[model samples]
Target: MSLLADVDFRRYWLARMVSLTGSLVTYVALPVLIYSVTGSSLWTAFVVVAEGVPYLCFGLFAGALADRLDRRRVMVIADLVNAVVLGSIPAAWAFGVLTAPHVLVVAFLTQILFVFFDAANFGALPALVGRARIAAANSAVHGGGTVLEIIVPGLAGVLITLTAPAPLLLVDAVSFAVSALLVRAIATPLQTGVPGPPGGMLRDIREGVVFLSRHSIVRTQTVIGCLQSMTGGAFMGQFVPWLDQTLGIRPTNDARLGIMYGVWGAGGIVAAVLFPRLSRRLGEPRVTLWFLPLSALAGLACGLATNWVVAAAMLGLWAIVYSMVVLTAITLRQRVTPDRLQSRVNTAGRMISFGVGWPVGALLGGLVSEATDPRTAIIWTAAMTGIGVVFAWLSPLRRLAGEPIPDADETPTPAQREPVPAPDRIEA
Candidate 1:
């Protein structure tokens, strides 16, 4: 069946899209609020630091907990928590008691909640869709959000100026509430069985790590995924300045910048729509092996292009290749992982890929851009992705290329058997 034709998936897709669109508004608004309130670049930098710290600190625990609890219940409670906290920004602003620290605290709190929400969500999607449609389901959810990402950031910028950043976050609060309702409305099971008393949290987390570290394809894809996130973060970090430095499109040129962003988003949209097909035809391993080099080449091309036209096209192509690598790695991890370990294992990997890799890459790219020019920095980061390509060629992933995905039955293994009986498949 077509993914959208499935009633619960349709609701699930809309819930994710709605939450993403709202957050995109906050993404711009929160920074604007901080700057307007504190007027300190250091405080502004704290916002970025605050967002990443929660992911690193709480990511694994959230995942471990999700696996032991009812995932959908966890998601719903998280959304409600997010709604109250996010709504606080506007509430404080209305009473004229808003401060920079208040906004910053809200920023940190919201992100912490996101770590939990996202952990539960990672598990919930696979449970809702089942294994057969995992790739397509992932694409549909990401594709919808990518489309919003293209449209909403620009609109959020405009809305910030018009409605003020503080008032605008209410939209985010409302979105979270709506998301909670939608998630609750789903008629399908979000887990295979009701969770029993979990073992030691540390022990549960260890099991996830040992499994990830031992499984070759899953391990290889995750390591490559970390590398991709790092370099991709580094590459994008220098993107704006590279445009100004190479093609003479200054930061103030919104029309040209908007078009460039739209072009990049279009590339993401194309990749998201096509990745499932690519995975089916080429297999996930081959897709990653083939595309890793293309991403590096495309990144290098963008760095080399002095003309705006060439730069734009290369950036679009780079986005496609780059996004596909990330998506395929995620799909591979989810496909191999048992449902019981889905949240813990996937979140553990993300803690490395996103929590650690992204911030580090941005910091490294910034340092490079400082030492040299943005153009040179872009080239350096592009070259960095070649590390992933080389590793792919040497790793077990290379041999797995062109092989079909294993059946779902083959996925659940004796290696990590739980004492819990076969799941009764009840709604949480």
Candidate 2:
């Protein structure tokens, strides 16, 4: 079916686009603000760390909660909380009360809330539409976000030039508020076909872990994703520093970084447009295996680039291939997993891959960048990314020809099982 035929998907896509634009605004503004405040690159890195750490810590728990709760409500609460927290920064700045400490604190809080929002989002999607449409839905979602990533940064760069970071942050806050409202408007019911046992949070967490362990496809995908994230984290963290220090581009002064991000987004947009068609032709797993290795090589080439033009070209290719791999993976997971388990499985998958890998990779990248040249770090990261290709190659997933696409009768599992209310004994 055409993506346009799905009104709910359209609403979700539009909401995500608005939210992503705000996210991009913050993405550009935060580093600039932190740098302006401290004039220390190290401090800026620390802020980045602060933003990611909480997500890593809370991701699994958040996933379990998403499965247990009303996903739309979870999304609404998450967006509202973020809107308030994000708004506080600008308010503080306007009152001359925004301090470095305030920034760090807010960054941490924002990440914490974001972890929950992200989990709910992943968990919620399969329920909103169905497993059959996941690929197309994901394309729209990723495509919209990619388009924003391309446009918003340019807008953000212009905005930064015209005003201070605080105002941009204020705009971001409003976007979150709007996103919350949009989420609230989604009228679809979310009911998991398989319910978890009544248990405490720790018990629920354990169940999620056990579920993942038994699910081979989910397990394999998670491992591959983790490794990819590790490499990506290392590349992003170290590549700029290397370019600045080794290639003689001023990382701090140049618009090269912005160009890199924009090009990457452009690549993602291309991939998102092509993914559904590509999956149809090559099958998802084969497409993933083919593209991932090539993307890794592109990453390696990106590390080797000595000039902005070459680097931008390589990064753009990397982004395109990376987007294809990610889109393929998401489609595979959504298609194979039962609906009731989708949120938990999605959370479990991300927790193992992204939640664990990002901070460790970033930390390692920083150390490697500090001890050697950024190029060296990038090369090492590229090698790691390439190594992940082995995981894809060896797994049963590689042999997976696209199964017949799911249809309406094939009810995938839900994100959570309906709770059995207290049993009432017959008063006879």
RMSD per prediction, one decimal?
5.2, 6.1
Query: Relative to the true structure, how large is the alpha-carbon lDDT of every model?
Result: 0.78, 0.74
Measured by TM-score, how close is model 2 to the native structure?
0.87
Tens-digit per-residue lDDT, 1-428, candidate 1? 48899999888888898898788778666755775676543344456556666777888899999999988889899999999999999999999999988887898899889999889888888899888889989899878877876788667655554577799899999999999999998898887767647779998888777667766767788788778877766665555566666778644424465567667777888899999898989999899999999998999898888899888899889989988998998888888888888888888888887777666765676677767777776788778889989999999777667456674357433322333333422110
TM-score of each: 0.85, 0.87
Worst 10 residues of 1 by lDDT: 419-428
**Could you tell me the lDDT of residue 237 within candidate 2?**
55
lDDT of 2: 0.74
What TM-score does model 1 achieve against the real structure? 0.85
Off by over 4 Å in 1: 30-49, 90-104, 160-166, 235-253, 303-309, 369-377, 411-428
